[model samples]
Target: MSQLFSPLTLRGIQFNNRIVVSPMCQYASVDGFASDWHLVHLGSRAVGGAGLIIAEAAAISPEGRITPHDLGLWSDEHIPGLKRITNFLKANGSVPGIQLAHAGRKASHNRPWEGGKAIFPNEAEGWQTVAPSALSFAEGGPVPTALDDEGLHKIRYDFREAAERALEAGFRVVEIHAAHGYLLHQFLSPISNQRTDQYGGSFENRVRFLREIIDDVRAIWPTDFPLFVRISATDWTEGGWTPNDSVALSALLKEQGVDLIDCSSGGNVPHATIPVGPGYQVPFAEQIKREAGIPTGAVGLITSAEQAEEIIASGQADLVLLARESLRDPYFPLHAAHTLGDDRPWPVQYERAKPRG
Candidate 1:
């Protein structure tokens, strides 16, 4: 049997396969409400046979959005729209998940199609950005306000509340977005976090914020469901967050009841040189899984069935998350089953087109 199609259980959730539809930002929401666009976008992947479908980063607070159009879970009003999508995914045989994130200094940006530039607080649809430090993401870019004790308390509260909303929305898995140079990643990387308090300075202090957020969310998030953290793993710059730090962090997260570490790299710095290629980030997953003794999800350029199969078969990672590849072919898993000679069932409506044996 193809290992990629093999069932794996995490906590109380059983994923029918290792194929996961990684959260890809749609930038299609209006006032953080999921529209029909989101419904079709996510629902199609469920129909395409992904075992798990994680919706894009939903801001824990309005200001946590990466763009004005980013999805959100900051209010009860956001629940019903998301519930509709989750219901469809569940009916179609996919475990629904959502990534709760705070964009931090990365917030208030124009959509990617609109040049991806920063929209200053003074600009329309933009609000003040906040972070661990008052540093700007880029030179001459917007300098975010340094978060104070009150601000930190709010962040934890927002995450806790958002987790409750996610539960109400019918999501079974929750991934805390501590990655991609965002708020939590900013706190983790010394390059971005230059504070002198308990939430910064030493490695232990640097991880304090994220640890607190996890505790806050996990407190309310049910024990039956799995909770995951997506970490950048490596900042890809000297003196930044390293794989060693990731290993140590993963170990701590495992102790904190985190089920998996979604390992990706090089998003904390703007100019860091990343050796981008197929499975380039898999080693981080392998290292963390081995050294930290935790399950890890391998993401980044894992585009093919064979490559994904090898990652799981070789004990490199427990799950493969596809973003762009899944975008190109929503049915990649169904097609992959054929490539690996595994008879994965297709959606009955589409079975008429299934390749004859």
Candidate 2:
């Protein structure tokens, strides 16, 4: 049997296959509410046969959003629309998950198509961003307010509350978005975080914020459900967070009850050169899993079924998460099953289109 098609259980949840839909931000919400676009965008992937479909990063608070239009779970009112999406995913046989995020200094930016530039607080649809240090992501960008003790506590509270809302909204898994130059990643990388407080200056202090957030979230996230953390295994810059740091962090996360580390790389540094290619980031997952003694999900440019199968079969990573490839072909898993000659089932409505052996 193909390892990609083999069932794996994490906590009490059993994934029918190793394929996952990596959370891709839609930037289609209004006042932090999921709209019909999200329902169809996410629901189609579930119907397309992904074992797990992680919803895009939903900001824990309005200010944490990457853009004004980014999805949010800061309020109880955001539950209804999210519940609708999770219900659809679950009913279609896919595990529904969410990524709770805080964008830090990268917040208040225009959508990608709109030039992806920072929007000043005085501008419409923009607000003051916050970070571990008073640094702007780019020159002339809005200078963020350095988060104080109260601010740090509030962020942890926000994350805990978001996980509670995710549970109430019918999500079964919650992956904290600590990667991709977001708030947590900012603190983790010394390049972005320059503070004299307990939340910065040293490796231990930098990870303190994320570690405590996990503790707070796990308080209400339930023991039976699995929790995942997405981390940038390397910042791709000298003097920035490294793979060794990721290995250490993963072990700490495992000790704190995290089930998996979704390993991706090179988004924290603004101008760091990354050797982007097929399976370029797979080594990060491989190293983390081996050194940290934790299961890992490999992501980044892994578009082919053979490559994905090899990753799992070779003991490199336990799961393969597809992002842009899933957008091109939502039914990539179904196609993969056919290519690998695995007996995975297709949705009944689409069974006629399933390839015959």
Judged by TM-score, which candidate is best? 1
lDDT of 1 by residue, 87-146 (tens): 999999999999999999999999999999999998898899999999999888899999
Clashing pairs in 2: none
Query: Which candidate should be chosen as best, given lDDT against the real structure?
Result: 1
- Against the correct fold, how does model 2 do in TM-score? 0.99
Clash totals in order: 0, 0
Residue runs of model 2 more than 4 Å from their true location after superposition? none
Report lDDT (CA) for all predictions: 0.96, 0.94
Model 2's number of clashes is 0
For candidate 1, report its TM-score. 0.99
RMSD (CA, Å), candidate 1 to true, equals 0.6
